[model samples]
Structure formats: C-alpha cells, structure tokens
Target: MSKPALLVTAADLAPQALALLQDFEIVYAGKTPQPADIVALARRHDPVAIIVRYGQVNAEAMDAAPSLKVISKHGSGIDTIDKVAAAARGIEVKAAVGANAAAVAEQAMALLLACAKSVVKLNDRMHHGHWDKATHKSVELAGRTVGVVGLGAIGRRFARIAAAMEMRVIGFDPFAKDLPDHVRPVDLATLWSEADVISLHCPLTEENRNLLNAQTLSQCKRGVIVVNTGRGGLIDEAALLAALESGQVGMAGLDAFAQEPTPANHPFFGHPQLVLSPHIGGVTSDAYVNMGIAAANNVLAVVGKAVAA
Candidate 1:
C-alpha cells in the first residue's frame, strides 16, 4: 500500500521534523507559493495533511484536498490560513503557539531600542559623513512607561524585559487573566494616555483592525514611540504616517506592514523617523526549529499517528 501523502507549503522544514514524516510521501511546495499552485498541488497529491508557513490555505485550496484532515501553521499567526473555511470543511487547523515567543519578544525590544536611540538614523548619517550630533537626541528607556497591547507569551516576555530595564510596564489584554508581577493591567485608554512607548503584540482580528487609527492616535501622548511586531492590520498606515509627519508620534519601529513585501513606492521608505524590518521578528533559527517540530506534531496528532515523545 502507498504511504499517506503530506504536503509542505514552505521552502524547507527542519531536519528533525522531516525525519518524523518519513513514513509519509512528502510533496514540497516552494515558499510563497501562489494560490493556484497550492490548489493544483493539493489536487495532484491528494494529501492527508498540509503544513503551511508563508502561504494562504484558502477555501479553494481546502476544497481541492479531499483527503486533507489537518492544516498546521508553522508559527503562532493563523491570519494567512482561513480558519473559518477550514472549520466549515471539518478540517482541524492548529498553530505552533509560543514556539517562537522568546525570539519575537527579543525582536520587539530590539525595535524599541532602535527607535529610542535613533540607531539606524545615526548610523546612516555617520556613513554619509554628516556629524550633526546635537540634532539627534535619544530618549532613555529607564523610568519610562511601556504599554504592551497583548499579554500573551510574547507580550509577557517583552514586559519582563522592559521591567528589567527599570521601565514601568503596563498591559492591555481583555482575555488575559493572569499577568506578570511587573506588568500592571490597564485598559486601552490608560495605556494610550500614560505610556511613553507603546508596543503591539496582539493578533489581528476584525474588532482590532486599524486599532491605532486617527482617534486612538489622537489619544496618545505627544511624541510617543510606537513598536509593532504583531500584525500589520493593527495600525492604519496613512494615519501613522500623518502622525509621524506632525511629530505627534516621535518614531515608529515596524516589522510588519499592511501589505506583505511592501511596495517600492510606499510612503514609509524615506522616512527618517521610521525603523523598518521585513516581517522576520520570529524567524530566528531556534524558533524555526521549534515551530517546525510543533507543526509536524500537530499534523501527526490530528491524523491519529502516535507522536513520539
């Protein structure tokens, strides 16, 4: 009898995770596969499980895979996968939650520090032989208030880091019941009004889409620094740009954007106050390995395979 087929929709998987699926016939799709490619592959392979990393698993793709029982996300975010559609088809959708929490939290702090110290801006100016030190003033993180939007694994870790730096840490998460000792629980309004630095760590949902828009931005303290390692849809780009221009928002550290692979002519490109990175906050080697293992386990568990301890 032929082995069960498994589809991998990423460029590669960890060696340890791949070894566990040796009993299955693996079909590898290149990273960032198009929607049509995914559907076609599903139809061709008749896979029982599909592991998605940086691609979409929409209704069309799910419908094509008649045998698919499980869809596993390589990381915590499931925005790329259509969970509602999968649920309708009776397909189990799972994520590797907390597999990359530490890595992501570290990245959030790195961005916060970069913005507070004007690291990128100064480095660029110095490279161009511009020695204007007096104009470039950096804020001290110690004694400042940091408001964390989410108190999940990543958010709590970031809060701990902030507290270690002697900064006051506050958090806003409606679902979170137990918060760290260092992080004071506060409402969204209090966060906006009192926080000198605001860091977003929540998943993007309909209710929180464009959470940092004109009205919310207006409520924030003047010259506040913002850091977002979470979803791009959490902030309104146009509104943020306007705030940055008017000096209401002193600086922004963005790892995710409203659009993936942000367009070349996007307004944020030349802004000196913005420090940007491609959405790689949780792409560290350690995180990749952990996520891969967790994703593979989820797939195996859903398929009734006895996952080795």
Candidate 2:
C-alpha cells in the first residue's frame, strides 16, 4: 500500500526529522509560500498532515485537505494558523513548545546587551577610524531593572540570565507558572512605570496587537530601552520610531517586525539607536534540529502514529 502524504510548508526539513518520517511520502512547499500556494498544494496533494513553517493556514486550505488530521507548527507560535478554522474541521493544531527556547532567549540577551552598550555604533566608529572612547558612555546593566512580558520558556530563560547579571527582573504573564525566585511578578502598570528596560516575549493575539503603541510607550520610563524577540505586531512600529526619534526611548533591539523582510524604505532604518535583525532569534543550528524533531513528533502523535523509540 502507498504511504500517506505529509506536506511541509518549507523548502526543506532537517534530515533528522525526515529520517523519522520514512513511512510517509513528503512534499515540500517552496520558500516564501503564500496563502494561495498553500491552498493549491493542499488541494493537489490532499496531505494527511501539514507542517506549517512559513505561511498562513486558513479554512480554505483545510477544506482542500480532507485527509489532514493535524496541523503542526515548526515553532511555538501558532498565530499564523487559523485555530478556529482547524477546530471546526476537527483538525488538531499543535506547536513544538519550548523547542527553540534556549536559542531565542540567548538572542534576546544578545540584543539587550547590544542596545545597552551601543555595540553596533561603536563598531562602526572603530571601522571608520574614529575612536569614541573619550565621548562614548554605555549604560550599566548590573543595576538596571528589566521588565519581561510573557513569562513562557523563552521569557523565563531571559529573566534568569538577566538576574545573573544583577539586574532586577520583573515580569508579567498571568498564565505563567513556577516562575524563578528572582523574577518578581508585577502588573503591567507597575512594569511600565518601574522598568529601565522592557522586553517582549509574548505571543501575538488580537487583544495584545500593538501592545506597545504610543499610549503604552508614554507610560514607560523615559529613555527606556526596548527589546523584542517576540511577535512583531506586539509593538507598533510607527510609535516606536517616534519614541526613538524624540529620545523618549534610548535604544531598541528587535528581531521581529510587523512585516517579514521589512521593506527597504521602512522608517526604522538609518537610526543608530535602533538595532535590527531578520527575525532569526531561533535560527541556530541546534534549534533547527530540535524544532524539526519536535514538530515531527507533534504531527505523528496527532495522527495516531507512535513516535519511533
């Protein structure tokens, strides 16, 4: 008998994960897949499962894959998949939770350090043959307070690292449990008013979209540094740009944005105080294999197949 089809919405999958799926025929969606591409592929392949990596999955695509029993995410965030639509069709939606936690947390730390010390700016000056030692001053992290939003695996790990640096770590996440002893849990208001740096690690939901818009930014301490390794929509880019321009925000380090491959003309560019990365917080070599394995397991378990021993 022919094996069932499993569709992956990326150009490639880790060989480690592919090795475990020997029983299934796998199909790959090309890089930069769009919604229509996913729908078309679903209709053409009629896959039994879909591993979402880079596209939106909605009811239309679900209807196209009648045999699809599960939709698995390569990473923790599932905001790209329409959960309501999947539930209506009895399709299970699963995420590889914490699979990339260490990678992303380390990235958040790197960004925070880069911002606080003006590492990027100083490097540019050095390359330009202008010594800035006489005029440059970097913020001290040891005595600062960092407020973390969303105390999940990534958030908690970042908080722990911040505490090690002797920085006060306050966080907010009503759903988080077993938080570290050093992480003080506080309300959003208190975090905004008291934090020297605000870091976002929350998921993107309708209620929390633009959570760091003008109003919230205003509530924050002036010259507060901002770090986001979370969803891009969590911070309003326009507001953040304005704050950065007005000196209300001292610096920003971002690994995510409202748009993927943020356009060349985007307003956030040309600001020395702002540091940007291509949303690669969880793209480490180890995370690739870990997330791939975990995503495969999520797909297998939901399809009533036992994972290999």
Candidate 3:
C-alpha cells in the first residue's frame, strides 16, 4: 500500500515538522502559497492532509483532493480557509492555536513602544544627519490606559505587559470572561472613549471587518495611538488615513495590511506618524518551529482518528 500523501502549501516549514511527517509521502507546493497554486497542488497530489501556511484553501482546492481528510492551519487564523466547504465535505479543520501567541504579543508590545517613543522617525532623522527632537513629543506609558480589543492568548499577554509598565489595561471581549486582575473589562464604547492607546488583538470576522472606521475613530480620544497586530481588515485604511491627517489619531503601528504586499504607492507609505511592518508579528524562529510542530500534530491526530474509525 502506498503511504498517505501530505501536502505542504508553503516551503518554509521547520525541519522538525518535516521530520514528523516522514511517515507520509510529502508533496511540496509552490514557495508562495496562492489559492490557484494550492488548488493545482491538491489536484496533483491527492493529499490525505494539507498543512496550510499562507493560502486560500477554498472549495476548489477541497474538491480537487478526494483523499483529503484534514486541513491544518499553521497559525490561529483560519479566515483564508473555507471552513464551510471543508465541513460539507466531512473534512476536519484544525489550527495551531497559541503556538505563536508569545511571539505575536511581543511584537505588539514592540510596536506599541515604537509608536509611543517615535522610534522609527527618530532613527530616520538621526541617520539623515538631522536632529529635530524638539518637534516630536514622546509619551510615557505610565498612568495611561491601553485598550486591548481581544482577551485571547496574545491579548492577555499584551495586557500583562502593559500592566507591568504601570499602564492601566482595559479590554473588550464579549466572549471572554475571568480576565486577569490587572486587566479591567470594559464596554467597547468606554474603551474607545477612555483609552490613550488601543491595541487590536481580535480575529477578523464579517461582523468586525472594519471595526475601526470613521465613526469609531471619531469616538476615540484625540491623539490616540493605534496598534494593530491582528488581521488588517479589522481597520478601514481610508478612515485611518483621514484620522491621521486630521490628528484624530496620533500614530499607528501596523503589522498587517488589508492587502498583503501592499502596493508601492500605498497612501500609508512614508506617512510620518505611521510605522509599518510586513505581517511578521508571528514569524519569529521560535514561533515558526512551534507553529509548525503544532500544525503537524493536528494533522497526525486527525489522520490517526480517521484510520481508527
């Protein structure tokens, strides 16, 4: 009997994950995991399981692989996968939840501190042989309020870090109860109005797409700093741009964008008050290994269960 096929959508999996999947006949897809490429790979390999890192696993891909028993996400977000389609086909879907939580939370904190201290702008100015320290004002985190949009693993870690800095930490998560003592729970309205800094840690959903829009920005404190390490669709970019121009928002640190590999002429590019990083909040070496291992384990678990049945 032939070994089961295991397809890897991206080529960057850690060696540990590759070693663990040695029992299966591995099929390496494209370096960049596009939806069409994934579909083509599925059709060619007829994989029993797929480890998805950065592609849209849509109905076409699912339909192409008749042998597919499990779809595993390398990270927590599953927005790119068509869960509805997978469920209809009786395929189990799993995510490596909390695998990169610490790494992402650290990145969020790094962004927040960078925004608060005007780190990027200062570094650029110094490199250019210009010093204009008097013009840019940095705020101290102590005594300020930080509003965390979610209370998941990442959010909780961020809240704890902020609290350690002596910043009052408040959070809004309808689904999360029993928050840490240092992190206060508040309504969205209160969080918007009172927070000096707002860090988004929520997952992207249809209902919360563009959660921070013109209307929501207007409700925030003047000169409030916004940090987003979550999905880019959570903020309306146009609204954020307008708010930055009008000084409604003081500064923004963005790790994710509405569009990946944002166009060269994107309006946010070179914005004085904005700090941008390619969506790499969870791409650290440690996170890569952890997420890869977790994703592989998910596939093994699901496949083992199927075999037993």
The whole-model lDDT of each prediction reads: 0.91, 0.92, 0.92
Off by over 4 Å in 3: 133-135, 305-309
How many pairs of residues collide in model 1?
A: 0
Backbone clash pairs for candidate 2 read none
Question: Worst lDDT window (10 residues) for model 2?
Answer: 300-309
| Residue range 117-198, candidate 3, lDDT tens digits | 9899889889999888678678999999999999998899989999999999999999998888999899999999999999
Candidate 1 C-alpha lDDT tens digits along 1-309: 688888889779999888778777888889778878899999998899998887788999999989999999888888888889999999999999899999999999999999999899888889999997777678999999999999988999999999999999999999998787899999999999999999999998989999999999999999999999999999999999999999999999999999988999999998999999999999999998999999988998888453232
Superior candidate under TM-score, 2 versus 3: 2
The local lDDT score (0 to 100) that residue 93 gets in candidate 3 is 92
What is candidate 2's lDDT per residue for 140-241, written digit by digit as tens? 999899999999989999999999999999999989888889999999999999999999999999999999999999999999999999999999999999
Off by over 4 Å in 2: 304-309
Error of 1 at 105 (Å): 0.8
TM-score (C-alpha, index-matched) for candidate 2 = 0.98
Weakest 10 consecutive residues of candidate 1 by summed lDDT: 300-309
